[model samples]
Target: MTYNLNRWQGYGHDRLYVNAGSRKIGWIDLKTGRVKVTSPAGWPSPIEGMVQQWLASNGLGHLRVKLKPRKRGDEITTQEFLDRIDRSRDDDQQPAVALSIKSQRRRSNAGTDLAKNRAGSAAYAAAQERSTWWRSLGRAMGMRTEDQAWRIGAEGEQIVARTLQWARLRGWRVLHAVPVGARGSDIDHVLIGPAGVITINTKHHSGQKVRAKPEVVFVGGAAKRYGQAAQYEANRAAKLLTAAAGRPVTVLSAVVIVGAKSVRGSRSAGVEIMPKSHLLVWLLFRRRTLSRTDVDELYELARRSTTWQPS
Candidate 1:
């Protein structure tokens, strides 16, 4: 629970909203359009200055909370979260969710952090690809646009489809990897059962260290490994989907390499962390059934989050 102060009450019919970290919280009854910081003294964060700087630079004057720092040596606990909320003064209390009255602002600063990743990275779902000034190059010969990652992140849909095929041959339903929300923005694998939804994230890592189970490796002493990245992605996806679905979505992420023929690690989850020399064999073994609803959801979700390159 977060405590918010209603300093925005007198905006006079203008709508407003605030961005809290990765999740956006809409404001209530005021303009939701971006504004600069007129007042700032609520949350506790080390990056307050940076946050203020960012908001101002983006033409966003008004600002709110941004980070959730864990203690010196502790992970964020529910008790701690509630305690922090309870202890904070409510001179102006803001709800976790905000409803605003301004027009939704278009994100338009410049140079996105996405510039720092695989084109196919899931970081920014609906980002427009960068543009070129070739048409205007003759007018300004020295002008140059930074190059974007030519390799778009792997399509989550392709990855999910492959999982469905792989799990089916084993007489199991690929239940948990579907998208279920109004916009289906949150992506996750959902295997709905009488017990509940079991979320699974299928990954394709090239390294030979079975990321899920790190013990099995024959490489140069686990040289540069994929640490908590896959799990972190899976966990985040689960949380978002859970919020969207209005319930907990159990999550399990597995790295299923399509080609690591040189792998020599033992399978931690009964599967080699290495890639298969023959991609066909890997697919054949993962055949599994899924409810039509789940399949449709996954496909639709994938479509929204994914597209294709015509071969």
Candidate 2:
């Protein structure tokens, strides 16, 4: 069968995708020469030869040495398979499992409405409270304290949740105040959509400037571990979802700063960083990486309270 080759230049490396008409067959990583085939029909006989010829013609023959070919009938996990869905097509096909997902979402939403696991609920619960009436009055008088930090953090998460309403209207599913691990920690927001899964860390630094380096972020000149925390959460979520789905799921991370006067950074130290205002635009414009079917199946697995509990 004849195939087409397309090259996409990414952040640091380039990818050569092999497609059979509209279906994505696989891709060749130009830097590593590692070939990954997602075709269920198995490795086609002519694909390797076609790839070799394309590389040679395009002056990428050096990558030939690193090529590791897979045997016919080799299978990839469900997660990898879903991630390999065609990016160019806006296919709205739903997975068979989606029928049950609708019920699950209804239950999850019911729980959310009761504030059982709603957005910012965890942060709001964790916020320190003034024991004395006088202390509450002191806080009302513009006192700065640890309680204030948590208060604003919860508010920031709520703001981001409102913004994510925009995402839901665009066919994306979002979860807020996801409880993670057994340490009483929680993820601010989790987004599932055409752009795949993302764990968002929301920070509110009202009237403060936020700056980021590759690995660290600064809020009002105070360095914080937002990047590392977000990446860690993404990794954990990926592992949990992969196990539940019986596949290798991939997750992305992002840090959204709310109420910041300005944001100065671009690179994601394993996570994307942006102000809350840009979150919607960034998510809406990202290349389509998941289909309606993929999103539904994953969201089905993610919304379960059991999914986040310690194993």
Candidate 3:
């Protein structure tokens, strides 16, 4: 009653080895329900009857079983055959449910740290009693408070999020302030839709000129690694999502400059730089690369905080 099963590498469909003792007597084409007997010359009638009965009980009685010559090295152990069948079945089945992600309680510490620094600076100035007037003047001129940096970044993220909200109407899903890695690094926004997944990095420079040229971005008059950072974020997101999806997931990178006096750039270093007003239009008109199913699965993976955290 032992069975030796082996996958038919030649066949394009599911093929199971029907074994008796240590020999392969036949192969059952599970997909077509057509059984082929390889060693029919001395095959036991009882074993054949049993196979036929099993197939009939399995609603494959309509299939015709025929005799054929045995191929070399077709014999395999019962356990091996069973394992092969199990793997084949697993490969054919789709996931019954989506992965459940646990909610993360961690909030952004960057904003809090900035606020603390601002408070500390003001207290230090007050204690000095001499530089207090200059510090107060600096504060009035927007120099004493370093918290403006965080506030500006947060404002840019909010603007990008609001702009991306239009994507929901177009069957897209957007996740804002997605935390990544053990460090405080985060993707400002992620958009998943028919066009594919895009990781957005927001830069807010009010009334400042922005310029980008292949691998370099300049805000106001200072150079920054905005393009490189966007590319890195996109790559990290794609890797995490590919693992979660059990398949390849492509991710694109973008940089949105909010309230910039002017924007001038092409896709430099694989990251697109543009004003916030154009983000929605760019996303909406890109060539569709994902279907509705892909969008749903990718969105689920992107929304999961655990996906980006190190194991």
Candidate 4:
């Protein structure tokens, strides 16, 4: 019996693709001279196109790469396929699976709610009435209000640009505001190294006030009670990401919550929440703790970690 990597499940399917080959994974279509490849639904482009740019370490760039197709004579059984799936699933993956499920549900619910509120809240009833159909054309489908999120994200972009500049002054290349996934909201500042990838989540809530403890941080003035949400979210994001990545994607949860009074000190629920001022220094110093292999891996992983669904 022969085995196959089930593109759908990302693991071996319960049943082997027996008689399916000696199958061709990728081949140059004889008539058209076009490359024909097998790909999973999750990927947008063809497999050949997707991995075309695949490169190994050594500061080398993308060279033409392709997957070798299977021979047409192989065969595999159902039991064998299930066994392979079990064999492939590592123990560390459980956490990432859980995290992905949670995130998926949260965003799913948020999108559903947004769909329910189609009418815009403008000043006049006439505008609301006239805009009903157009309002239906636009709606949020995420946990955070997209508009506010973008504005806040823009603030974050500024902080990243400034902080990255500061880091650059100290000889660091922190890729700021790059997307880890297709969603525009899902972005992270990345530092790649042998120790793995460290993705930073930046939040800018200026002039609120700052109070901190290891378990949580409170950033606001009045009856202000900021929970450990940001830190928790960061930690969760890291864990989930590591799992989804199917490798040891080391993640460091961080928050740069800007506020009045040039904040000082450091604390985390399980992360490092600090001022934007501290980010450059912390990252610069942390650079010493990693290795060259880590740097390369981090850079690649940062680019690949983005996950998205096709509409």
Name the runs in model 2 displaced over 4 angstroms. 1-116, 128-137
TM-score of 1: 0.31
Model-by-model lDDT, in order?
A: 0.36, 0.73, 0.64, 0.41
lDDT of 1 at 79: 38
Using TM-score as the yardstick, the better of models 1 and 4 is: 4
Q: Name the best candidate (by TM-score).
A: 2
- What TM-score goes with each of the models? 0.31, 0.62, 0.57, 0.44
Candidate 1, 275: how far from true, in Å? 3.4
Q: Across residues 21-86, which tens digit of lDDT does each residue of candidate 3 receive?
A: 776565666665444544533333345456666667867666555332123334343234335445
Candidate 4 runs further than 4 Å off: 1-153, 166-173, 178-185, 194-196, 222-227, 230-246, 287-289, 305-311
Q: Native-vs-model 4 lDDT?
A: 0.41
Query: How do all the candidates rank in terms of lDDT, highest first?
Result: 2, 3, 4, 1
Tens-place lDDT digits, model 2, residues 85-119: 33212353332112132332353332233224577
User: Per-residue lDDT for 19-77 in model 4, tens only?
Assistant: 12354242222222222233221112222222322223322233232112123343333
How accurate locally is residue 234 in candidate 4, as Cα lDDT from 0 to 100? 45
Candidates arranged by TM-score, highest first: 2, 3, 4, 1
Candidate 1 lDDT tens digits, 182-264? 44333333343222233343343343343334534334345433324445545665665444434455444444453333544
State, as a TM-score between 0 and 1, how close model 4 is to the true structure: 0.44
